[model samples]
Target: MKPKYITLIIITFGLLLGISLLGKNQVSLQGNKELPPSQRKLWSDSSHRQIYPRTIQLIPQIQATKPWKIVFVSKDGLKGHQFHHPGNCRNSSWCSIWENAKQFGDSAGVKIELAYVHQNCAGIDECISTQVRLIDDLIAQDNIDGMIVGPRDSNLLVPVIEKAISNKIPVVIIDTPLNTTKTLTQVLVSDRKLGEEIGNWVVQQLKGEGKVLIINGPKNQYNASERKKGILSGLQTGNITILDIEETDWTKPEAKAIAKKWLKQFSDIDAIITVSGNLALGVLEEIKAQKREGILITSFDNYPEVKNAIVTGDISTTADSGLNSQGSLAVKVLVEYLENNQSFPSIVYAPKLELLTAEQLIQFHGSQKSKVKNQK
Candidate 1:
């Protein structure tokens, strides 16, 4: 063959080889030709099945638009009696979340709206139904640019969240985790870790041996269940005996009633662990009313009354899981993703758990006052 013709034939053969390899590498979604073992394995893997496409195609439009509306769906509404503190708006977690979300949204130049389940729900089932209805209404409105949800039940909220995603609305789960991975991001505290810390604190206070009681939140809630598990795991390492495990609606009256019964039944209860600050306050009030003594109390959350109890030496200690920041962070994350196409991890944990005691609370406030004085 001529030298030029020989070179041309070589190039044509190389192109054919490249095309053959490319065909083998591609995996077709619709066609059912037998794939190579490696490609077939990917389809059979469970982890691969969980992968979801990013359906939020409205980022560019949201970024180009001004004053996008974002809604925060809270688990419960603001109620003064719930907190038992003078300033309900300042102390309630629901209010804190709304205020922080609104502040952040305002700063980001987005409009923030808050919707919450009615507190008078007959039961957990009713409350969850209310939440589902609220989310569906928001999604159907078709005006919201983004959504941040503090889900009441992890599994029940999955369908609505997935629906929102399919509708091209980015959803960010806050406070409690959602069961589905279709969310844009999750900003929350590690409830299990916080519970473990509380357990550890109780063990240390009791010197590795004592009888304790647990006042837990609702059985079906994710945070409540995880925290209870963590508390149990932490207590297992020590010679601790759990006197009783009681579930509450995260309410003061129910917890107080439980505590009253326990105070009457058990005289040697060494410590009490509550899933929330409000519950702790309820237990504390009952203990005081009965003139009980020497019972150490530990709790979760950053309620104002919890802090006051720490300052007054009424309770042993409590964990601050950064409840104050979860809402703000969720709003911030969603807004950043909308405006800048920023990608974040599936779970964005708030600051680490801070165990608060009387001394620590006093010192923290003193330092704050000093900083203000210095600034002046």
Candidate 2:
């Protein structure tokens, strides 16, 4: 064969072999005349089934985009993954925010890193120290450009949030306030309104005339104060007797102990209610122990025990801060800022609180009961 002709033949054979290997097509056995894929005894043993295409087809008019990285920091820990927290239920204030971020990230092909925050929420100096250290480290790392946070984190996370604001990392506060910080722009969910909701419910349930005990949060917390004010305002309507009120420090055991101690003193709390779950559980423990079945206990938060209590008639009511909505909103807000390159208010309140009762438990979404019922 002429050298040129030989070379052309070799090239043609190579190209045909390449095409066959790359495309999904049948190969025949020596004499059986059966399709290579169909005759295969096992899928794993087949070599002629198909091959990956080496060339990628690219559209000439489209441009590649960069992925946006969004970071969410909160003292409430990661939603749905925290050991004791109800992330799946969006129990954390930012659960909705994270959900929104996740969806938007997915849609825009962005990446998000949500940080489980730990800050001194007790208003204690030493605990605040550790929280400050961690938040400072994150800020100094300059790893993420944007942040969404709940400034009034337990104890005194507000101050730590100040450090974040100082670094000019745009942040949004939920369920708390940066009241003292001038750097904060906006806030979410008026805790005061939530308190008012509790009080209003109490007034209606008790005909605005029963004696009620108020369990509250730590002294300086903005949300705590607002909740107290709301409850007080709502209860001021008519013959509602102002019963003995105590501070639970928003701690479950503490609230329980306080309830026990106070119940002994008052002896006639027609209604025992708290704005925090910790306080609510405490009230439940005290009443159950003392065999006081007449006292109706109302509470807040999506704590499991709280939910169970409502389910079994152990407690009168429970409320959800619309976790999914809040989380989704936070993400929506953050994405807006990212896309617009504009400054946002320091706080973004998602005050959509749902009143939960035995009659309305399903409406408030007992996340578990609903799932079980759906499975059927």
Candidate 3:
């Protein structure tokens, strides 16, 4: 199989535009009646310079007075009990935000109540049917002032978000933010930068030549597209051949089915690159099963399975997006907005990711050595 080192390079600099896949075509806004055009990125000229939105205006801090009531809606579950977390949250860092928010609320004299959307972040249909019901209950019966939506849920819950905004309920989009217009402040990772990171990593790994396959995330998340741009842009300088790129809905089983199809179509493929943890897991299994050990497998997020795969030499590399940091930052911005009447940029790109090895994952999670190297 392709080594983890190669995967790391592709992710780190994959989206360095003008050099790889991203800059080949401009990512522009086209007027579509169904969807409104959101804020464009605020570009800055400097090496790794800060990229904040042009609309952001600095305002003075507000003294914490009344308790800030915050609600949490996550897609995760503990077994069939459901509605807890782990399933929908993928047991990702986003889940920890609940705890952090609770603690912060308590310390700052804020009241917080989290609404578990479901066992996992399944998509709009499931969220509307399940999580939306929970939100209605919270608004009608529960005692929270506002809500901190789980990442990627913003775009999925646009209509609902609009309703909340209309109700004067502050909604902050956590990780996987989409449709910043309806949100108070969208806080999450800089997918474009993450993509660039991947691109650079991939080029260095191939020494500039290979057939690479890019995997997209859930059917509608904005992060997936941006990450792709970064990956392609970063690969600009390298002689990388893209075999194909497909979306996997971020589901492992779905990814497996797609992998089987791809393996059959491109048996001689050189690498499989993805931005979803579950998708990467599925691809890794297919590669191992087919005995195509020469194929490189890489991806994003801090999912345990993906991290363990890297440790045991199954996955190439994955990055830590500080899942909890997503909620924390948005909370800071939202609290500031409510009190100071200051509005941050419509979109806020998160901090860069940290590279983690299998060993590091195990260490971070306090798992056993065997677990770190476990193979499915």
Candidate 4:
């Protein structure tokens, strides 16, 4: 017999064994009440492992016959590592996505290979070309079975992703979305909603009338565009005047430079809204260096340094985009499709964005410490 048939037989036997064990154990998988409505339908199979929902059932019974190779293409590789570390995954959407995807891949018997377009690319055009070339090469080589991509430019990646789909490889878009609808699923957070909430907070802080500066990510990114729209919508409810809107590469240095220039130009800026945690930190650094006060800084992504700044009252608030959930679910969705030919919703929104403040973090930490003391 052929290797493929033999592998199928092995997987079939494992499922049978899992079913038998289930009969004996009667294990039940409980749905997490905290999960968003879209992902609340959790289920378990014979092995009693909880799997993501929106499946036809008997999903856990399906086993991969071979180690499915999946490639995760991130827009930023090295620069992302500088902020998103394993130890501080909670503070980074990228790190959380990477770690959660790896963990899920291990459990589902899939091999996830990490790739990036920003590895050595000199500029935006080069990065786009590099990403296109990399995905084309992977498809041409016929090595990877699935792809999970956090695209830098939503439009630029559509054709390459379409080509991958035509070649029959499953693709999952995460973090940022692609413009096309050909991918298996896109796992993401509502960037607009997060921005709106932050904008509302700013309105409240400045009493519905103040000058605010918007520090946004690259205009090419879908998330950045959505966030700008949301922020504008939220700010419209108030008498807030947008002092200036600056675009950056979502890096600290660029944000810092912009903040420095803005501080000099606009002396009475009331609030500063940044699209990323690093940008917020950069703004905070510049504010402190200049001994500026009462700016009411807000940012997206709950980075550890940002959290610390919040505690110090240097930053007002930040939103958590549920990066870990997005990462894990992206892997789960892709693996399910690859293993059992399961169908999923075209877009799977991650758990809702969480707005974080210093007061909330302090209370949470106090509760956690109390729990530890009680346990001891």
Per-prediction TM-score, please? 0.79, 0.68, 0.67, 0.80
Instruction: Rank candidates, lDDT, best first.
Output: 4, 1, 3, 2
User: Which candidate do you rate higher for TM-score, 2 or 4?
Assistant: 4
lDDT of 2 by residue, 217-290 (tens): 76766677787898898787657887677764566778888887877888667888787665787778878888
In candidate 4, stretches whose alpha carbon ends up further than 4 angstroms from where it belongs are: 1-39, 42-66, 82-85, 88-92, 371-376
Sum up the clashes in candidate 4. Answer: 0
Ranking by TM-score: 4, 1, 2, 3
Which pairs clash in the backbone of model 1? none
Which tens-of-lDDT digit does each residue in 261-322 have in candidate 1? 99999989999899888789899999999999999988887666678888899988888777
Residue-pair clashes per candidate, as listed? 0, 27, 61, 0
Q: State, as a TM-score between 0 and 1, how close model 1 is to the true structure.
A: 0.79
Candidate 1 has an lDDT of 0.76
Q: How close is candidate 3 to the true structure, as a TM-score?
A: 0.67
Residue 241 in model 3: shift from native, Å? 1.6
Candidate 4 lDDT by residue in tens digits, 1-376: 9999999999999999999988643322222223345535554311112434332222433346779999887666566655555566544457656776777777778898777654766656677788888888889888888998888778888899999999988899988878887899787778899888888888888887999999998875678888888899889889999989999877888889999999999889889999888889889989989999888888887656777888788899987776666666777778788777877566776555668888888887787789889999
The 0-to-1 C-alpha lDDT of every candidate, in the order given, reads: 0.76, 0.59, 0.63, 0.77
